[model samples]
Target: MPFSLSIIAEAWPTFEAGLITTAIFCSVASVLGLVLAVPIALAQFSRSWPWRVSAKVLVEIVRDTPFLVQVFVIYFVFPATGIPMSSTVAGILALTIHGAVYFSESIRGAILSVPKGQVDAARAAGMSYPLTMRRIVFPQMMGYVLPPIGNQIVGLIKDSAVLSIISVPELSMAFQNVLGTTFAAPEAFVAVAVLYWLLTSAVTLVMSRLEQLTPTHRSTQEMTSLLAKADR
Candidate 1:
């Protein structure tokens, strides 16, 4: 059977709303999650065992559990504990927490990759810890981390669709509504799929360009290998 996307035009308003919502969700979650992830990543390398353990446990719990279950707990179960939240708020919290766990690992790896001498130089130059990190460490770390960070962001963007399950009316829910009312499942899903692809591909392109531009070459061979893969 030939696939058709013509039906999507009539349903564009719903699709537009869902697309906007997903974009907002991902933009906020990525920023907030990365911010929250920094400390979690740093805690892993802290001298204090309690900090390490707490960070580790939070990461493990998020990594181990299914995201859908986490969403359900936040949306459905938490209300029983008297902490009321809108579905949008619950979805935002769930997505941010979940992505932060994964983002933290990339952050940890990047931190470990930063050269000791650069950090020493920053300290010796009278830079405060926060300033040293902001000026030297994070800038350098992004070179190493940006690709993986991009991967995580793209995954999180796709994963945001799952929020539709709790009634936040993101892309997937928008598609579902179109399907239910118009019975045009193919067109609705095709449109959603294309939109998701465009969004993810844009990130991949930006990150790939950044990876090439950034000087994270701890091992020259690794960069060469990545370039070769891109050529393929």
Candidate 2:
């Protein structure tokens, strides 16, 4: 079989459109997911049993089910409830919710990872609970949370492919269309895979740079303090 650069060249416009759609979906979902996640994470870490239980149950339900099922439920079943949404909207909603559940867990874990003594110190300093969390805990937790959040963002990009099942015209759908038109499955898929690889690598590179720019860990701080004291 002859190599066909024309197949890719012809599909470029469709692929570019699909890439834009996928990026938009992922960007919206990531922001919405973070908005949903913070409150859920707070609920999960709350003192009230009911709040924690409800949050946990919601997280468990979302995490246990496959994302494709969630998309189908949102797109198909939601219409019966008198709330009609387009496939793209439903797909975005599903992806956002799914990502929120996982991201909430990451946030909760990061918050809890802060030493209890830090919370106690804030309390002893006469800081209100909310103030203490805002001033002390949150800043520290962000450093811990960022890496996992970056991973989830990458996962969300890949998971956006599932939206094509509902006709969202994402990258995977564009690849399928190319295959249908040109009968070039391998080349089309190869191009799609390379695009995805580039997307993920870019995310990883950005994340690594952010991590390096962030402050050093507690141990590093402690070691630095000790060195300063010795020098003094």
TM-score of each: 0.84, 0.91
Query: What are the lDDT scores of the predictions, listed in order?
Result: 0.88, 0.88
Candidate 1 residue lDDT tens string, 102-176: 999999999888877877888999998889888888877877788889999999999998999889988888988
- Prediction 1 global C-alpha lDDT: 0.88
In model 2, what lDDT does residue 206 have?
86
Best by TM-score: 2
Q: 1-232 in candidate 2: lDDT tens per residue?
A: 6667788888899999988888889889989999999999999778999999999999999989898999998999999999989997898899899989989989999988888788899999999989998888887777788899999989999999999999999899999999899989878988899888877788789888987887744534566898999999
Please identify model 2 stretches exceeding 4 Å from their true place. 217-232
Clashes of 1: 0
